[model samples]
Target: MSQSASQVYGAVQALTQSSDTLFLLLGAIMVFLMHSGFAFLELGTVRKKNQVNALVKILADFGVSAVAYFFIGYQIAYGNNFFVGAETLAQGNGYELVKFFFLLTFAAAIPAIVSGGIAERARFYPILIATFFTVGFVYPLFEGMIWNNNYGVQTWLETHFGYGFHDFAGSVVVHGVGGWIALVAVKYLGMRKGRVRAGKHTNFAPSNIPFLALGAWILCVGWFGFNVMSAQAINGISGLVAINSLMAMVGGILVSLFAGKNDPGFIHNGPLAGLVAICAGSDIMHPIGALITGGIAGAIFVYLFTYLQNKTKIDDVLGVWPLHGVCGAWGGIAAGIFGQTSLGGLGGVSLVVQVGGTVLGIVIAVLGSIVVYGVIEKCSGLRLSEEDEFNGADLSIHKISAINED
Candidate 1:
């Protein structure tokens, strides 16, 4: 039997939609696993006394973010909702639904970044509230502006600078904002007990180097999904993003290995700095450009982290600001340079526009964090009690240690 041409076209459309839905779902799952990476990373960094708390907090925060993003964040960012009837919702192979799941993972990352900075001393419920608030409100505002062009923000940028800010996988949108917000959290939470002496950090070393390495490895592996799957559909996927991400990661590892003077902590975290920086330009950048960007991010993390600990006495527990905030901003700007055709990129970027966007994200992050965290601190307190700090977050908040005994 001969079929109508329209029927054939419709069939092809269905198949494409189904394939795209599957692709995004896989990406969401991979990103979902990165939360565990967050868990183990913090778990490995803090003392064993606070290990259990670190694990519990990250998992719990994911739960909070899910609700906030689902109920509010998505609507604010893209002006969409899932309130339609079941039959209507089932259309397009549930592609929109899967996309929401994928982006929810990104929104959740904001709190995950904050978790590392304020670990060991923040009250659990308060942090959860802040996570909900930021993911639901603060992050989506800027995310909508840049990604969705809400309130003509992207339009304005392109009109004035010949290009809008281009963050292929959210260096500024996610990592930068998270990192900056983390700085505010850490500042308000203050240093852990015995963490400072006179004018320097007390230098409490990582509790579990193996766990730290494991966490880094997980995130490294998962980042391919983070950058590649960012295409969000089968047709848009590109191998350039994958290779770029790899080269950048390697660059970070080697650079930090040398710059850090054989410190295992820096060696593991080096790739992360690279990954964060490459997120904005991975799709547009050549492999060599990515390597340079990653290497620079690694050096930035090592040098600044050391200076903060040794001289400034800032207690950014895991150096989230350097690794994510500063490196994330670098990624945003690096895209403007590396993504230009003259430098082996696809070239739809402007350095001026990139800088403006980076600064805007940072300013939004700073103001939003101050307002949200400050209000919470004043209303209900953000940190654990002095006694709780001495006893560790595990024993103080959860009533159990990572290793319990009779």
Candidate 2:
């Protein structure tokens, strides 16, 4: 090639890299905004007295998560760190930095998910420590294995099952792991004070329906970035992923409307259930298949959440286990089913691998949650005192209430 041709080629390549960086930056921003959704969702779900604590914890957790991921978690998961010179980092149009920002949002989501389940009664500092260790160590372990293909786990799956595990956007990696991890924290922390007095479970209503609905909306809108931008490049973007996500969201809504008996809480959360379930297969599943996957997930969330609260007495505040944990696992398996050529999906997904990978994720999350939360409970304690609980987390922890009197 001539000198002019080389120059033109270099310019085009630079432009492509710049565009990709900007695209991913937008996606990172959207996913980052989803943290606010997590905050308000918890705030609206918990009792009025604990609303301020809910808002504070989510923001604090995000800040801690960024620090942990930057210093240790990102390198452990991807075998790269930011210890190099700024000039070296600026190469590749600083895409690596923005990519870190994108994945950091996903990493921070682990503690954000757990925050909902253990809301209202958890001690502030202990929970922050949990966030640090979780984002810094536990989440990155499985993340490395799945997304980064560390330890040849993906290779082993493909070798054994004729295809690798296919989680296009972290059904098991983010939502599954976060949801399952939240379960341990919830169970260990136990029910809130008076939550199960007289052998009867208390049915606490959401403090603000509009706030809850707003959270659901923000999450729903941001999910496009979560799913569609997993491709990580403009050239790799697909309308299929976007449409599948939309179909699944609608499916979750319609199913939850009927299954939840039109309860506003369930109705609002229904779309989240669908989106969680569709994350794994959005790239491969047809829109119709995504709908079915999401619909089932919606039903699962409503039914299991009720069972957990009433029968099992788990006291998971936001039903994170059913909505994210179980639904996310279902998504992993559904990807194998719905991504099959016979199901009107793009093939090359394996059921055996999907199930195996999902199970691995569960094991990692469960063990990690147990060890981290367990140690914390044994040492510094996890729950608030009965007096503190009665007074509410806002006044007890943050020294303020959600609503102030003039």
**Top-TM-score structure, candidate number:** 2
Q: Write the per-residue lDDT of candidate 1 for residues 1-406, one digit (tens) a residue.
A: 3568889888999999999999999999998899899889989999998999999999999999999999999999999988889898789998999999999999999999999989889999989999999999999999999989999999998998889999999999999999999999999998788876675567889999999999999999989989999999999999999999999999999999999999999999999999999999999998999999999999999999999887764688889999999999999999999999999999999999999999999999999999999999999999999998889888899988898576
lDDT of 2 at 83: 89
Per-residue error (Å), model 2, residue 61 = 0.2
Full-model lDDT for every candidate:
0.94, 0.95
Q: Ten residues in a row with the worst lDDT in model 2?
A: 192-201
Using all chains and alpha carbons, the TM-scores for the candidates as numbered come to 0.98, 0.99
- How many residue pairs in model 1 have overlapping backbones? 0
Candidate 2 vs. true structure, TM-score: 0.99
Quote model 1's TM-score.
Answer: 0.98
Clashing pairs in 2: none
In order of listing, the candidates' clash counts read 0, 0
RMSD of each: 1.3, 0.7
